[model samples]
Target: MRQTLSNPPSGKKTIKQRFLKLLPCCRSDSTSPIIQNSVDDDFELSTVCYRPEGLDKLMQVTKFDKRELQILYRSFKSECPSGAVDEETFKLIYSQFFPQGDSSNYAHFLFEAFDKQKNGAVSFDDFVTSLSIILRGSVTDRLSWAFNLYDLNKDGCITKEEMTSIIKSIYDMMGTYTYPCIRDDAPKEHVESFFQKMDMNKDGVVTMEEFLASCQKDENIMQSMHLFENIL
Candidate 1:
């Protein structure tokens, strides 16, 4: 039987909980500073307070509360003292959770998804924004983000090659941990199955509309989404 979102497997953490726990504890004594500035001239000026860059904006945009943001920020700072994560550090951090698997390729894709700025680095704003959507956004939101990830070339459509690459990378990352042992042709088969459903016009490419419609109608795929949540 397929698992349902309502009934996650026993002892497995929800994506949000798992990510929170995975964050390394903050070891630094320094706190993120709050800036305050005042200027007085002929006219009186009111005091302005500036919280850490993007902190307030993130709170407004994401599901995380102030306390949760504090925890995440502290952890992010601890791991990435320079206030940003490069691809190499990202792969290293991802490898820790799946020690039995080769997480490099999957990590590369994930980092690209999170690097919204396309600057070869992921800032805290980019990190938390993606996390919030995956962990707590509406189904449409999550699916849209997944679509963007699969699009690869930002072409607004998903080709079979792009989907195949994604599936193969996932299988390679899962390695020996997958039960029943994946076959050599498993990635190809998986891609075929998805294309069969998602390529609505038989044009060899899946548009975002086709992708979203098919995914929502497919109960099994929706349930399986939780299984891959740990990849983030």
Candidate 2:
């Protein structure tokens, strides 16, 4: 049987209980009910069809016209069951459902959503929580996402030089086609500094073991590595 993006509802179980266990891979405020509610609310809002009369209104959600709804349904029907939503998929959905220069993209929404207190940037905690909210896949999928960041050389082992390349690839994937868009968020000096962090053993290069150790504590990361090895 194909998997649904979300597990089928176990009748009679409360949403609170469900929410408590949903994102096992994340380190969220398990005690704060408000954070939990905000994440859920944002997710529900995203699923609605959004219409806009102008760029300023692009972010507002609205009712979908019958014809527009049909197109949305047919388009989604074309996808395979294994192709459930992910950050990349969400971006496409937003673009098709609501279009207005970058307003239709997930990046802008994500940046704005996580920029709490009206700060232009997001805290690491906020960013990770939001990502966990969007990515429902288990630990394995999360690991794949991280590995996908570092395995830019695609040779499996990540050396220092390859580490820098991987960071650059991540920025490129985020929709910046420039040579080094990572420099936008991270200074060129800071971007290069990631190699220092990854080179944990200080042997001048990093092996899979070293990289895994740094992120191994994250169950999501390990699950991905396990799945990756099995696939290979």
Candidate 3:
């Protein structure tokens, strides 16, 4: 993807728009509950969130078959002892976590993720850049938790629909966690509402053109990567 913004200062922000750094968060820190929430356990979604390296570890080691359940079990052991799934659980239930289904869907998901312009097609860098965003928090917080949050359907890969919903959840979550830094309000809603209208061509889609037209930031992308830089 382009390392630079889509358009220059000579432009606008698209529709009702809203808009990672990582930390080696210690196992425990008690400044505030949200900060404290940074702690990890296997079952907790926070623990599941992971960056590129971690995702690579996950994809590399994870079994494509029944072995998935075992890993889930370990996560539960680390994070939640009370509500773990039993050995008798079916594979389909676990399937819910794999948000992207087959190869085609994975391709689509990757396309959206890496498509810097949002026109939908994977780029080498945008696809890889999210690693920085993913690595911004504890393993659980970045992967499982982020996954769980974005995977509204409980499926593993975040779909375009899921992405739309999550864009909102992302803001709400940020406001909640960084209440002091950023006031609590519907910033995500602002962004989404704008995007909906910016579907100006009525294509039922929003483009990077529409997006760039809308934000004040020099770089109007999701800016998730900043978390890694900011935290550091």
Most accurate candidate by lDDT? 1
Q: For candidate 3, lDDT tens digit of each residue in 1-232? A: 1122122122322111100011112112454223443434324544443355655554443322222323333433443344332221312322232222212333233234434455433332332344333433443334333344344454444344665654443333222223233333444444455445444565544444443343324343334323212211
Candidate 2 has what TM-score?
Answer: 0.32
Query: Worst lDDT window (10 residues) for model 1?
Result: 41-50
Give residue 3's lDDT in candidate 3 (0 to 100): 23
- Give every collision pair in model 2: 139-220, 140-223, 140-224
Clashing pairs in 1: none
Error of 1 at 24 (Å): 9.8
- RMSD (Cα, Å) for all candidates, in order, is 8.5, 17.7, 15.7
* Candidate 3: segments with Cα more than 4 A from true spot: 1-164, 174-185, 188-190, 193-202, 206-222, 225-232
Ordered from best to worst lDDT, the candidate numbers read: 1, 2, 3
What digit string (tens of lDDT, one per residue) describes model 2 on residues 122-156? 43334334344334445444554445444544465
lDDT of 3 at 30: 59
Q: Best TM-score goes to which candidate? A: 1
Prediction-by-prediction clash tally: 0, 3, 51
Clashes of 1: 0
Summing lDDT over every window of 10 consecutive residues in candidate 2, give the lowest-scoring window. 1-10
lDDT of each: 0.72, 0.39, 0.34
